[model samples]
Structures are given as structure tokens and as C-alpha cells.
Target: MTTKPDRFARWLPIAASLLLLAGCQAAKYRTLESFGIEKRDILGSRVEAARDAQDDAREQFSSALEQFRATVEFDGGDLEDLYDRLDREYTRSVDDAERVRDRIDSIRDVAEDLFDEWEDELDAYENANLRDRSAELLRDTRSRYGRMIVAMQRAEATMDPVLEAFEDQVLFLKHNLNARAIAALRSELDGIEDDTEALVEAMNASIAEADAFIQSLEGSS
Candidate 1:
């Protein structure tokens, strides 16, 4: 008997391949509609994807910050090993940031398509009251989505400076692998703390927005 994890592991690649194919096919609106996925459902899924991406990003940033903190508190060690660890963290952080950016772009793309379709459909509605109600819903959804994306973008922006700081420190340590470098990093602790805290706060806000957006969708559904 195949265990759940074993079955999942066996099908993982197949599942991934199917998802890729589906995404390619779904690029066509007709394909999406043929699959019975509505614009609102697409938006909801995209929003959730963005939220999960943001969650991953927040955790990655926090992990990187912790790594930096550990480096700053370094008493004495093999400098090369220290650089290796820091380098790994920096690379992971960069990858996570890129994923977050891509997720946000996906959300934006779906939102634009959704809103355009919605607006065009509004013009097709014959009943005046229905048209008016749909227009109002479109406006409200757009406004809420705007707030969520803005918060997500703001959090994303904070990542650049933080990543730069981490890179600079890593590069500096790579060259000057000595006690002096550790002391210098200790001096930067306050600034790094501030940046990390700000990032967490922004991420929290974005997550709250995501929760609210999801709740709104659920309520309507």
C-alpha cells in the first residue's frame, strides 16, 4: 500500500507538469471560461497566491535578518565558513524577493484583465439596476484591491534596501575576514534592526489586507 506522502511524491512531477500546461492553456480567456473558472475566482486565487508569496518573503527576510544578527554577534570563527553561511542567506533572500515580485506582477496582470472584462460586461447588461449594481461592485473591489497591492508593494520596496545592506556586509566581510569586520557589523546592528522591524511591520500590514480581501470574497461567495 502506498502511503500518502509516497503517493504524493510519485505524482509531484506529474502534477507540476499538468499545472504548467494548464497555465499555458489558461492564458486564453476562452480556455479559462471553458474550465468554468470565473474572473472573480481567478482574482481570488491570484490574491491568495500573492498573500502566500508575501508570507514566504516575510519569513525569508526574517531568517536573513536572524542570520545577519548571528554574524554580528560572532565572537571568533573561521571567516570563510562565516562568509559561506552569510552568502547562502543572501542568495535565499534574493530568490525569495524575486518570487514575491513575480507573484505581485501576476496579481496585477489578473486584476487588469479582470477589471477590463468586468467593465466590458457592465456595458452588456440590459437591466439598468443590474448594471448600476455591477458597476458599484467593480469600483469597490478595485478600491480594496488597490489598498492590498499598495501594502504589498510597500513591503517589497523595503526588501531592496535590506538586501543591499546584507550584500554590502557580506562583500565587506568576504574581503576583510577579520575581527575588525565583525566589530564593524556590530556597529550596523541598530540600523539592521530598524530595517528588519520596518519590514515585519509592512509585511504584517500587507497580510492584514490580504485577510480582509479574502474575507470580502468569501462573504460575497
Candidate 2:
């Protein structure tokens, strides 16, 4: 049986790695600040990147769905080539989804650091009126950020189910590359289309939220 110490030991390297990564990120931000690029600017840029990534992912999923549809409707093409095309679409969709997730993570990392620094620096202000105004601004910014991130996370959560459905269709067609497999995939085509539609809608909402958040950050600056 694994003891508590064994569990702790197993996690130690992961914990240390996280600390090292955090230190590196802090150093990076400091370097950026020295060049007059603040965390708010970084956050806004990351949000823009994540929004763009989601947009790309939305288009990718739509394309992948189209490829799947084309595969089901194949009348007399190279069956092997059709399968290859579907596999390629699935691979591309996976890569796009990964990019979207990475961009969201980067946004979250920078936002947290920005908020923490903002909160800590609030203690250094000697002017009462300025401090109160700054605190109020921070609260408003945090509230808006909370909404934006929730929208982003909602969109992110919809991705996996759609990707899984796509993977299933691709793998099924791979194993049974013939007319019958194409027919089998026809039943799943509508389901994939529906899921992709939902994912796209969610991504659109998230992208809108990111745009608004970036605009707000710019307005405040």
C-alpha cells in the first residue's frame, strides 16, 4: 500500500516543477515590464490570442465536420484516399483544439498574476482617495474578468465531446474502409454536425467576451 510519504514524494517533483515554472514566468513579466509592457497589456494580448485560437478551432471543427460529411456521401472515389482525408481532418481538429486550450491557459496564467500584483500593490498607496478609486477599478475589472473566463471555460468544455465523436468516426472508418463503413458513418454525421454547431456557438460567445474584456482593459488604460 502507498503511504502518505510515498504520495508526497511522488508529487514532490511535480510541485518543484510548478514552482520553477512560476519563477520563470515572473522573471519574464519583469523583463516585459522593464520594456514598459505591463501585465494588463499582456493579459489583453493573451485574450486576443485565445479568441483568435477559438475562432480557428471553430473553423477547423466545421471543416472536419464537412470532411466527415463528404466521407459519408462518397459515391465512387478512392476509398483509401477518403479515409486518409478524414484522418487528416481529425488530426487537424485535434491540433486546433490543443492550440485553443493552450491559449486559454496562457491567458489564465497572466490574468492571475496581474490580479495578484494589483491587489498587493494596493497596500502601497498612501493617498486614500487614489487607493479607494484603484480598489474600485480592480473590483470592476475582476468582475468582468470573472465573466469572460467563465464564458471561455464553457466553450473549452464543449470541445472534448465533439473531438471524441470525430475521433470515433475517423477510427471506425479507418478499420472498415469500404462502402459499408461509409454507410455506417452516415448515421453519426448529423450528431457530429449538431455537436460542432454547439461548439461553434459557445466559441463565438467566448470570443465576444474576450473582445469586450480587451476593450475594457484598453479603456481603463
Candidate 3:
């Protein structure tokens, strides 16, 4: 028969081994939590960046449309040429904006998945403490908002020159057309011009709102 002391000693080693394994499992869980947080941050950043690019493209598109309208108002060297150029530029801008939008959508999907995973992991923990991780995620989100502001500014800068050119073309067309012809075109042209102005104003307002939102996010971060 085995001695009682020997049996107890043998059981003690096995118990210690089990405790060590449990500790390791806990460490692994923490590691996964950290990974999830980082993933959320990175994906959020990508979505913001992509949105910024899309906004810039939108501004360009608006500017191009304004230019096209202005060109039509004025008689130019070759109306056909002007129309062709406008069509090409519009097509290019649309393609770029669509591409950026698609990217943003993809990033959003990834962000949602990351958030879900994070939530699931957090729920699994009884005493989950994620304050630092949350802060990191907020900071990353703010960075993305900042990028959007920069993009809007860039878009505005690009639009100024285009707008000026467009205005000049309109003025030229107005000067060259016969009085009766101008009168005939005025009604249609006025409507288009008004629409262009409204769109530009709306875009400006959107930029301002976006800037304010970004500022708020930065303050929070």
C-alpha cells in the first residue's frame, strides 16, 4: 500500500500544474482583448481617411459641374470641345469618388466586425477593465476626423482656381453672345447658375459642419 504522504505530494504537483495552465489561459485572453482594441482603432482610421478622400472628390465634382454650367452660358472658341472636356473631367471625378466610397464601405464593414468581436470578448470577462483601451480607440477615431478636415481644406483650395476659371468662361460667353441670343438663353442659364450656386453653398456648409464635428471629437479625445 502507498504511504499517505507520498500520495499527497504527488497530488500537489498535479494541482500546481493545473493552476499554471489556468494563469496562462487568462494571459491569452488579455492578449486577445488588446488585439481587438488595436484592430478597431486601425480600421476606424482607414474609414475616416477614405471618407476624407471621398469628400475631396465630391468638392472637385461640384466645381466641375459649376464650370460646365458656366462654359455653357458663354460662347467659347469651341462649345463641342468645352463639352467634351467637361464630360471627361466629370467622369474622372465620379470614378474617383465612387472608388473612395467603396473603400470607405469596406473599412466600415471591418470596423463593425472588430467592434462585435471586442464586445464579445469583453462580455466574456467578469471584471473587464477597458478604460485605457477605450481611450486609445477614441484617439484613433479623432485622428481620422482630423484627416477629414485636412482633406476638406485641400478640396476647397483646389476648387477656388476651378471656380475662377469657370466664372471667367461665363463672363466671356456673356460678352460675345448677341443681345437677343443672350436673352433667349438667359432663362435656362439663370436656373442652372442658381442651382450651381446653391450646391456650392451647401458644400461649404457641409465642410463647416464637418470641421466643427472634428473639433469636438478632438476635444473629447
Candidate 4:
């Protein structure tokens, strides 16, 4: 009974341990799939949402500007109320822009994480002689779209001051160009109308440019 143990018998425990390790690794892979699902795929969606918000804010701002211009030019009865409404709308527009910017930033962060994850997955697949087939690569393509949204937001922020100044000028003109002043310098007031036209043209051009930029970003995404 104390005879030498068979060599095959001596190796049985080692073989069993190897099988157990392989099973553990397989279970780990299944867990990984579940973990991956918890992380939502929001890259494309976020970019699109941000773009829509930006466009809405811009359109509202433009409408308010138009209303302000018309009210000031014609001495509308509700001039003061219209101006107040326009100011409030502008404030809301700025707030909306900030929200859009924040959303773009969030999307950018998630896109970066997605890119890293894709790279890791690709490398693993390659090392294991597997084909790289993951939709995560789409994140790289859409990431630039997120960046474009951010750029537009920066441009919008830069233009905000210019717009405010323009609005203030309109208010000043409206206040100063009452019926008495208009009668006093009727000819000069008529000339001033040309300047107002030019100012409105400039503002419209800016709005168009911003809109175009936003549309381009949406198309790219």
C-alpha cells in the first residue's frame, strides 16, 4: 500500500486546478458583458440634443431682436412691455446656450471614454485572433461633432456681448427719437434710419452664420 504512487495520479490535482481557472475566466467574461450594458451609449444622442437646444435658443433670440426693432421703429403702444419681454427672452437664450454647452461637454467626456474602451477591446480581439467588430468605433466619428457644438457655443458666447450692445443702442435710439426729436431733425432722423437698417443687417448676418454653423454640426453628426 505504501508503494510508489503512479505519475498520472500525481498530476490529477494540477489538471483539476487548470480546469477550475478556465471556468472562472469564462464566468468573468460573462460578468463583463453585463457591466458594459450599464454604461449607456449616449454619444450620438447627446450631440444631436445639444444642437437642437442651441438652434432653439438662437431662433428665439433672433425673434426677440426682430420684435424689438419693429417696436422701436414704429412707436408701438406696448414698446416698454415688448422690450422687457425681449430682455427676458435674451436671458433665457443665454441660459439655454449654457445648457447646450454643458451637454456637449458631457458628450465629449463620454466619447473619450468610449474611444478608450474601443481601443482596449480592439487590442484584445486582435491578440486573441478575433475580428474587431464593435460599434464603439462610431464614437470617434461622432466625437468631432460634439467638438463642433462646443465651438459654436463659444462663438455664441462671444457674440452675446455684441448683441447686448446692439440691443442697448436700439433702446437708446427708441428713447431719444421721440415725436419731438423726430420733428426737430426730420431729415437727420430719416438718415438715421439707414444706420438702423445697417445694424439690423449685421445682426441678421450673425444669426444666419450661427444657424449655418449649427446646421453643419448636425449634418456631420
Give the candidate number with the greatest TM-score. 2
Candidate lDDT (C-alpha), each: 0.81, 0.86, 0.52, 0.49
lDDT of 3 by residue, 63-108 (tens): 6766565555655466556555655665566565556556655555
Q: Please, what are the lDDT tens digits per residue for candidate 2 over residues 1-221?
A: 96433544465455545556555887766655554557786788788889999999999999998888888999997999999998999999999999999999999899999999999999999999999999999999999999999999999999998999988988887789889878977888778888998999999999999999988987887
- What lDDT is reached at residue 76 by model 1? 76
TM-score of each: 0.86, 0.88, 0.47, 0.50
Better of 1 and 2 by lDDT: 2
lDDT of 4 by residue, 1-221 (tens): 42112332344355435546555633533333333321122444455565566566556556555554454455435545655665675566557656756765765665577556656666556444343334443453445444564565554454455355545544554576454432333343333344434434543444454355445434543
* Candidate 4 runs further than 4 Å off: 1-40, 76-78, 127-163, 166-221
Which residue pairs in candidate 1 collide?
none
TM-score winner, 1 or 2: 2
- Residue 112 error, candidate 1, Å: 0.7
Candidate 4 is scored at a TM of 0.50
- The alpha-carbon deviation from the true structure for residue 62 of candidate 3, after best TM-score superposition, in angstroms, is 2.9
Q: Better model by TM-score, 2 or 4?
A: 2
| Candidates by TM-score, descending order | 2, 1, 4, 3
